[model samples]
Target: MKLTSTASRKLAALSLDEIKEAQQEASRQFEEFKARGLSLNMARGKPCVEQLDLALGVLEALHARSEFANSNGDDCRNYGVWNGLPEMRAIFGELLGIPDDLIILGNNSSLQMMFDCISQGYTHGYSGCEPWCRQGDVKFLCPAPGYDRHFAVTEYFGIQMIPVPMLKTGPDMDLIERLVQDETVKGCWCVPKYSNPTGVTFSDETVRRFARLKPAAKDFRIMWDNAYCVHDLTDEPDQLLNIYEECLKHGTEDQVLIFASTSKISFPGAGVAALAASKRNIDDLKLRTTVQTIGSDKLNQLRHVLFLHDADGVRSLMKGHRRILEPKFHIVLDALEQELGGLGIARWSHPHGGYFVNLDVMNGCARQVVALCKEAGVVLTDAGATFPYGADPNDSNIRIAPSFPPEEELREAMELLCIAVRLAATEKLLYERAE
Candidate 1:
């Protein structure tokens, strides 16, 4: 699909009469959308049925008669392998660019591991440091338009969240460096590669800056969530600097804790999650986690190991994922281009990989747009959800998750989304005129 050039005049430039006409047309389309009674949702970044079906081998990888022991002869049927299966760790280590000894596997959710890390800081402290719960008014640096679940965890713990601007390259490093100077600032959340909603991969320089951070707090950490490290949608994928290596260079390897998983690559609920940090951090984490449970499901770990044998196997699997995801994303882009292109009221990112397309409609129009879509039987992730504390000062950003729906549904959803955006912008403009 050919995109319309931006050379045309913006919506804000049109005369009162032209704006009225546009508003009337948009309102008509919105009503027609409502009449269709289409229950479409583009809210969460869930893999499509076909993508999940590709990993059905994982279910059959193990059985009652299968080998219950790992290569090290550690019986997976009973207790032991406290950290994780050695071969599984090695595979994840290779995939995440970390040493196997520094990596530790958890159950299914990397987010849970992240919460535990923060909980550890709050409860027991890190490497014998003072517990954050005992500390006065601890704060966390949150890069705006970030993952909502990250914010949710911090909020649940009652940690103050400070919003820092996020750019196409990465978070604003200058501000981050300045903010960490406060002793009360305990940590920062990061989604380095193919980040949550905007899909902004941190540039080499940004990562290097993160590594060299000189914080006032002894336990300042960078929660590096590399959830989409291998979820590339193109052959020549965007490269991300290795945070662990960069931290090693700066002699601050303990300052970063990397999190990753096979959630999108395979089944979401049954996938494996892992954390890679400094030996000291890993030791501290293990000491705290020892009280939680005996060990993670080694049987499930064995299944993942058998299904996706190595880094090469994971890469090949991701290529299959791209074939399904790339077109869905394209449908969204095409619809946006054909409908709202050349209209200065909106702008969106064209990510090479990641599950979402970040759309920034006209300021103050996002919530109205979302409401309009919902009223028309289409649901979107609420406006300002990407920001810390559910606030977007300008209320512009909207994360579009195109992966869950089928191709035709995605096309229709995008069409409705575009119409909602236009209608909201039109309404806002008319109201401004009246005022």
Candidate 2:
């Protein structure tokens, strides 16, 4: 049978002979792909060279000697402004919907800030609480198919991670509400807007529920990594309810720590990062920073302030990113639809924004699929990297980072990936049948 005609049928409905034939075809295509010597990567959610080029003007935003000084007349070349420049804080404050006083600008990495937050809690503890290390069996809630780096940070500190299922609206709130009743559950990791891998934006109700949460741990905090707050692909971009705003209404603002960065907006390595929290939390964190370092790179912060100017400038630049990235996402989604839509072996996200396409292949077949893709010269994010401790119990979810590869390479990579998915699915089905 022609694969195109059978493509719409579920694999379970196929006869044994048909399954074998499909497997043979996939193997043939896989070998052909290997012979082509293709070296394409869809591993990390890194911006492409074209996206990077969009920020070329930022490098020259501080070309003159006078430009080194911030709006306050403070020369950015020297240290002293630990809380970052006032104007720089204003830019992030507008973007994040938080007051400038509540925002603490950091280095280029929000991940580093997140780690430091956890580290501080681990080593020194939050106010009125014992250090996390002293608390017997400290735990954290990790929404599954979540950001790997978030899990990595928690894991590095020996924090027990509890995998909460991610729902269409957001993480399983019911489970989180129940889990947080345990005082040992110190915090949770969240990517509320266009969340990593899955691209599931939390609903307004979800945000409200988060704000109203009465966790047993007074020190329970939400690591709100709003990494894709401004990254939109469609004219109708996803709107994430301002968690901080919601928290304030419920008087739970101190429980949420918000993080965002210009890593994707500008240069990834040379961008500015910031954290927003309640005044109490901010003051506590500021005190820690005094001992940590004199200050972050204010010069880079000034460049970002001059370049991005404000929230509107950030939006304009993201539109350019969408233009380049939107097509790439289409390439991956369209291929998956065309090749594996009704195959009953794979399903993936159609993200409006964010840098990854979350794909779930047949259970017990994801690792095999990734391995097959690698052998055929296409690299994908590790199959289990989406979960806590790098373990996906179902072993089905895969993160496809389409931003880094060129369109043609991405197209080729997706084609190979589809074939691998089919081959692995068929092999698993055949083995199960024989058993």
Candidate 3:
């Protein structure tokens, strides 16, 4: 039946016949399904196998003749360059849309740069300020439903996490501005473009407010991890408001620390990453990182430069990735629509880009749904993995990573996923009604 505007609760609930019919349609698939003996994962943000194929050439790039030498004519084969070589820094700066001077070339993983920054702040200090490890208490504002690794880093440091609500435009800016005013709040983590799980981009206003934050601690910084800067799956890309430029416009360029990685672009294990920020922040970051090494691999930098001359090369490559991922994405989306379009028990995002699709199930049923999927041999990201400390107060957010699986696998996975979702949601509803 069609739902009328301003309908009452009783009218909104589907009739018993509709529910039974829907269940039967779903049951036929489950009853007819056979054990495919497949052990698949749709849990992590890792790139798809076909997408990963794009970087296979990087192995040759690494072994190529002339690209292995740095600015000083040194061999990258040796152990050195902890902050990364210059050519690599240039590649990262170009990739992330920042000036090379402001970008610090990090090793293979961008997560390490973030982790190292936090570790340094806790110990040595940021830009001549008092070390956070020396402070009695330090707090971080975590944009809820964000990257798990970021939260994991902060949690490992015993830093207190204050959850900030996320919206379509970005994290609730009003709440962020107010909280930052407190002296104890020192930092916040943000994946500005195509944010993990939610795929929400930060609006111009949100970026502006973030740049202008008047934190009580002079050392407070915005951890801007733009991991999906070039990963647009749709033909029409979702343009993001550059937070670094917003900072410059707001006259607070010193407040943002941005990072990007080529891990997803090339090889996750051997890719180069970089950190972009104000010169002041760079100088400070160098103080800690400088002692860590001599220079990053100029060879990989040269390899990427030789391979992908400019941003266009990156875009051209992503087009290839989009081809592989877009169809798989639609497969999951269609299955969700087919199985749960108006059930009033679940909702999910159809993001134009990014590696994830966020599904919010009936309140308190997400963990149960994830458990059900696991029993059927499909591995999913932990139900609460999107939130800080792996705890979702509502237990409703479920991140669906579609990039890793093939279309056929995704279709089957999503079909099974719908059953799991419905079973868990129904049980929760009945149990709650009983209570």
Better of 1 and 2 by TM-score: 2
Give a tens-digit lDDT track for model 2, residues 1-435: 545567768987898899889889988988999999988888899999999999998889888656577778888999888989888789789888989999999998999999999998998888669999999899999998999999999999999999999988999999999999999999999999899989999999999999999999999989999989899998888888888998989899989999999999998978988999999998889879989999899988887778888889898999999999999999999999988888899888888899988999999888899998998888888889999988899999999999999999999999999989888988888888789
Local distance difference test, each candidate: 0.90, 0.90, 0.80
TM-score, ranked from best to worst? 2, 1, 3
lDDT of 1 by residue, 89-208 (tens): 998899888999999999999999999999999998875789999997999999989999999999999999999899988999999999999999999999998888888999999999
Show model 3 residue runs off by greater than 4 Å: 1-12, 15-38, 62-67, 70-83
The C-alpha local distance difference test score for the whole of candidate 1 amounts to 0.90
RMSD of 2: 1.0
lDDT per residue as tens, model 3, 134-224: 8878999999899999999999999999999999999999898889888778899999988997999888878788877888888787899
Best by TM-score: 2
TM-score of each: 0.98, 0.98, 0.92
lDDT (0-100) at residue 397 of candidate 1?
92
